[model samples]
Target: MNDTPGWASPGSAPSDGQQPGTPGASAPDDRPDDAPRPAAPTEQPGTDPQGPGSKWSKEQPPPAQWSAPTGPQDPAQTPPPPPPGPGWGNQPPGGPSGGQGGWGTPGGPGGGYGGTGGPGGGYGGAWGTGWGGPPPAAKPGVIPLRPLGVGEILDGAVSTMRTYWRTVLGISLTVAVLTEIIVILVQGLFLNDYADTSALEDPSATFSELASAMGSALLGSGVVFVISLVGTVIATALLTTVTSRAVLGRPVTTGEAWRDARPQVLKLFGLIILLMLIAVGVTLVGILPGLLIALAGGSTAGAALAVLGGLSAAIVALWLMIRFSLASPALMLEKQGIRKALARSAKLVRGSWWRVFGIQLLAAIIANIVAAIVVIPFTFLAAALSGDGVGSFLDGTGDFGWTFLIISGIGSVIGSMITLPITAGVTVLLYIDQRIRREALDLELSRAAGVQHPAPGTTPGS
Candidate 1:
């Protein structure tokens, strides 16, 4: 009786070990119905056991024609024929019944020869793991097309700067030099000698004199702050374009970057102003109650409450700032308006506020540390070359004349050159990474880069 389905019955050669046409061969009814019968031989490797095959006949190939090789064949050479088994009318290479290199031999496909393995053996017998695991994610450019870790994000920024140093450094250096020149000119012409703070140092100074001095100082600082803010906005817009191109493994010139960034520069400026106003307004609201109390003659208690309120407002402002940190990149890269960009950044940063904050803080710390290393030395040197010498400069009483301003401005320019690219690159890369994690933006990036990415629901193997 055959246990396996679709196997031909061994009619000519009975199950009682008698060959066809022999005297001891019994009729089919002589053997019990439940007795085991060997399966019919298959013609091909890896064929389904239940599928149809060529008809079985009493005739069979000779033992030598179907038997396995006697000795272990050289694995490097061509593989030998598959070993013979019961249905092939041969006892295999061992005992007459069955033994090594026979039907149940280990390391062979389905416990026989002709399997995925070494020379003549099956896969599991000789060597270890057949193939390695799945492939790594695609990296068509500076970053891989997947969600990134912190180190990978930072490395991508640095890699972009290094790979396209000509464009990156050229843009950064030009912007930094122009900004420093304007700042130096403004300080030297309007604030250096005209805005006097000497009244702030006088013990007998009248209230009006102190107020006038303070107002002048604030006006000068406001002018410088506005100039610096404009410079920062321009640099950010340009560098955002550079970094986005670098991620596609494309090189960009200053002209190309300018053309791309020019359209959205105004929107980016508006976004920055709106964010600043929100922060300032929140801070003012926090202290408003205390100011009202102080006007009603509760000065001591009002001061205490104001300090507490200010600290809490600062924390809230910081949270809002981090939450919206991605707006500039969104605005520049997506050509979004101020409100839309702010909403987009808020959406991307919603669940990852702390993570975004940590990365931004880390980048800021690293950029500042590097800038300090480059700037502090120039500051000392500038003091040494100034008119009052290092002592007066260190004491903060020296006149910041052209010599001091020029020397120190050179240092500031150099510092900005290094830090600007880093900060801009990190911001852009963080935006890309967030999109990759949230929206599977890597597929679009891969297509944009001309890399062949698998379709959705498919893998590299498929």
Candidate 2:
């Protein structure tokens, strides 16, 4: 090795215009342009006192054989950052695992070492949930209020329809058609009845004619109404069974849905009929109040009507809401009396009536709108067809006596098919929710829905 800084052999041609450090050497400015100087004393392998003016350490360990450390041995390069403040990192000193020293043993909790007898070998209580942190605060309505994926929900509905649409739709439609036929028959039998009874027609008439027409129409309509009511109840029950089965991913026979529907048939009918009565009563009272107010002849009768009707309807609606929110669940899951079912529904819907109401209304409105869109044209057709049957029933009130009845019945059936499933789905879901609230249904459902059932008698709420 050359003793001089950048001095070439004493007699060699000078390199790069040089000044040599030695008394008689060729030179490249004594700085050697081809090589580089170490930045720090600790970075250089050997001291270079006789080299370029740069300082270098003689015993620096070859600068770690790699690039200097920058920003902590990157987590990717090092073992996942010591797992924060605890030794989830590795086994500590004298530990069982083959961790390079200072790592704890795998037998940390029980009899092996000084760990708290925590389940996973460390202080189990030391972590909030071992899931990383405190449970996130549940946002109130924001979590579930938004409509879920339409495609998913509709897909479930479509599947339900596929399995159930045949029997349910067929039965409901048959009942509807039968009712419509009866309505047309009765309309033909007593074509003059509506005018006699209605306030819009002439008052004085022949008594026998009026009596005959009125009696026939009343008997006829009553029969149709009863049939329609029964049909609707059956439809609701069946739809609920189908919807529940769909949600649970279990296939059900239409016969099974019908069977399940049997238990709640009368209850559903009674409930619906009761609601209808209340609605009629509400409309009467609501309209009466408006009329009375208007008879006082205020300049604001319309507004008063709008306001009063709205308030009254709202009250009635709320009551109905509290009453029926859990009806389907009651029907689907319980084998009890109407009063008990109502009580169960009430209890389940206690604090969440408004939510249930909103959801129910949403389901109803959506179903009704969809049903209406589907049925309106069919209604027109039925009415037109019936007009041919009762040519002069109204002479020309659009002559819609028999036509109206027939169309109304047919439209009702179409409406029921579309709406019943949606209503059932909504009610059943609410029922499940109530179960969650009253019975911890979420956890229970999680368990029930698990691969194997959870512990034998570990019911949800319990």
Candidate 3:
């Protein structure tokens, strides 16, 4: 009798008298007799009758005989047809297949190789889709209309100048020239009177004389500070508009920027004044206790109180400054009042204090570096050109003539022209970035730019 393993098809069974598990049977005898046997071959559960594991199943049909065609067969052999359904026979080496390779076919909806869905996709596989896709491409502007990195913020500032050099440079140069001229005139007319060395060299100089000199110096400095503050506010207001238009890839003239910014100039100035007053008040309050103590004749205790109070006041002032740094841009762009702008700034900065602070600090450092690069050489030239040379310049013992002032003013103008736009642009862009992250202002920006369709997840007025 045919005696191949019972699992073999009838026609393929051996023509011998051995059954499966016998010494001469093709089936291996690894299992002990007592071991539980798999389901019977005729009704094996979960096993595909035609699969590789079931090659010897009795249900399999006999193989078809191969016959040469009447004409010459093609030299290349025809590949075997794939199995009917999903299984190893149809699967590629890479993975499950509908085509070449596996599920990770290149250039498919699933990104190249194992990537899930191109750049739009977050990562790979089901997990990537579940997590959602990446943010949409930012529209062109001074910035990319997204959460900005520090480098991008800095670049945006520089780009504002490069993109709109004439308007930006004109505004800055006018302000710088006017400011320098005013400063030089004030010094030459009033402040320079007290800069004489005779008063310093006089052995009989009284305390009142010294007090008068200090008071004069303070007054001059205060006047200069006020002028500088006014110029800064104007620059900031105008530049805020420039930056806004630049962000939308729109050109803005100095006239247009000035006109738009003019309405908000007073509000911005008020905001600056309010902030300054708050800072000054806080510092004064902190130092008041120490001043009282000192006046009461407790020198050591007064000194200690002064130190503690100053430190406490400084901390509070720094915190508030950071919290409200965006107020200028908010006021200028939104045309909000002092209190509203302050509130808006506080809201935007609520959870991003450190980030804002770090960026502002870095911008300040960069501005200073740029200023130094321009100013340092001019300082040396001024000193060398002065009749008294370096000694008189360093010691402040010689008169600073028109030549020194003019040369230094040139440097000041150059430095201001570059630094003003950068500082103002960074501030505006920072405000916009914060809004984009916290409030999705990019939608409004896109709409304003005449974008026909908003990106996914962005709704109108949202």
Candidate 4:
């Protein structure tokens, strides 16, 4: 193992007669090519708790040990034809859209985990593409240095789960309860009001009366919703920020959290509103085109609408993600304004959008799965017991509607609450990492944590 830091010239004869770029290639890239290998993924700066910098293992493994390029890589090198069979993005490459990832799959030109002897081959990371999605996350336990996607989000979630499952569960339970309470209360108070009012009950009110009533109702609901939304966002962001601070081995005082988070409140909310606006605009545009086409007599209006909606949603989702991935960290740690934070996020996530996207997607899926397992059965049972429950309650039927509703509510609340803290904590942490990756945010975080970086030549393993 010839140990070297940073990118090396292509033709150096590594111990196994190998070249520098293809660490795990088993063979070297021809000297004529003379390109350099990408730096071994770093352990991230400011990661060492008690040291000056991260504890990076300088030992360079064989090219084979590193990921091989799975599909035709090399922007200059075109891919051979597809291997036949249902190959959409699966096509070899060289086309406009055939190749998905920089190479064949998601990550990039490198072999990645899928190619058998990838970085995560034997004792890779903690959750090597298994904790959730198609594969586990590449790096676990350590926070990323850039904006993350759902899968990475899940990996962080799982990592946090391993450490604080009980706390997370409790939080989830709390969130679930709060959510259910809010839902029930709103329905009972407002929805029930409409259900009971004669004017509301009447479907034939004049346009003026209807407009007035609707406007009144909507205004009232909007006020409440705005209040609730602001409160929830502020509360959730603070909770998440503090919990993340704690998770990252930093301060956990409520006062400290409030102090650090208070000013950033409006910034975070602004980001949220920005995202909502973008989502609304994209959805509206996509839906409009489809609707217009449908009105103009398209046979597959439904299909077009669905396609446009899905595509627009996917693009907007990705755009918003790239835009805001690292903003939380900027707000929480750098104390930047929302616009600046968002810009920081975009800057940090310049080249690695998909990876972040995948990680986040993974996180969402995990939380969803956990929530589902706990909520679905109870939901069914609730439906069975109430006037709204599935089966009509006969006089002889067990009077368990209340029980079912309460249980379901509890289950939902528990799941949401617990998941919320964990998710929030991890996501915020990851956001910090993305900034660290880009702007050495870890150094700031470490300073906040009062830790030093390891000096040169001090290997983590050593």
Instruction: Give all candidate RMSDs, comma-separated.
Output: 12.5, 15.7, 11.1, 26.1
lDDT of 4 by residue, 228-281 (tens): 444344445666655565445443455565676778777777877875566657
**Candidate 3 vs. truth: CA RMSD?**
11.1
Q: Give the TM-score of candidate 4.
A: 0.50
lDDT of 1 by residue, 55-140 (tens): 34445444333323464555688566565442233322322222244433343333334232333444343222333334466788
| Candidates sorted by TM-score, best first | 3, 1, 2, 4
The count of residue-pair clashes in candidate 3 stands at: 0
Cα lDDT of model 2 by residue, 42-140, tens digit: 114475543665443333434244343343465476544344455233323333433233233344433323433333444433233233432232212
TM-score for each candidate, following the candidate numbering = 0.66, 0.51, 0.68, 0.50
Candidate 2 C-alpha error for residue 124, in Å: 27
Q: lDDT for each of the candidates?
A: 0.75, 0.53, 0.74, 0.53
lDDT of 3 by residue, 1-462 (tens): 554345443323334665676543445436544343342333255766566765454443323322224534554875654553422222222233123333343344444443333433334443332333344555667676656788988999899999999999999999888888998898777777764334545679864465356557656777777677667667877898899999999999999988898888777778878988988789889988987987688867886897799889989999998999899989888888899999999999999899999998999899889989998899879989988898887877767788888888899889988898888888898999899888878778878887643464543221
Residue 178 CA error for candidate 3 (Å)?
2.4
Find the number of clashing residue pairs for candidate 4: 56
User: Model 4 off-target regions past 4 Å?
Assistant: 1-178, 185-236, 296-310, 387-407, 456-462
Misplaced by over 4 Å in model 1 are 1-128, 189-230, 295-297, 454-462
Candidate 2: stretches off by over 4 Å: 1-80, 84-155, 167-192, 195-230, 270-314, 382-396, 401-415, 446-462
Report, for all candidates in order, the number of backbone clashes. Answer: 1, 11, 0, 56
Worst 10 residues of 4 by lDDT: 94-103
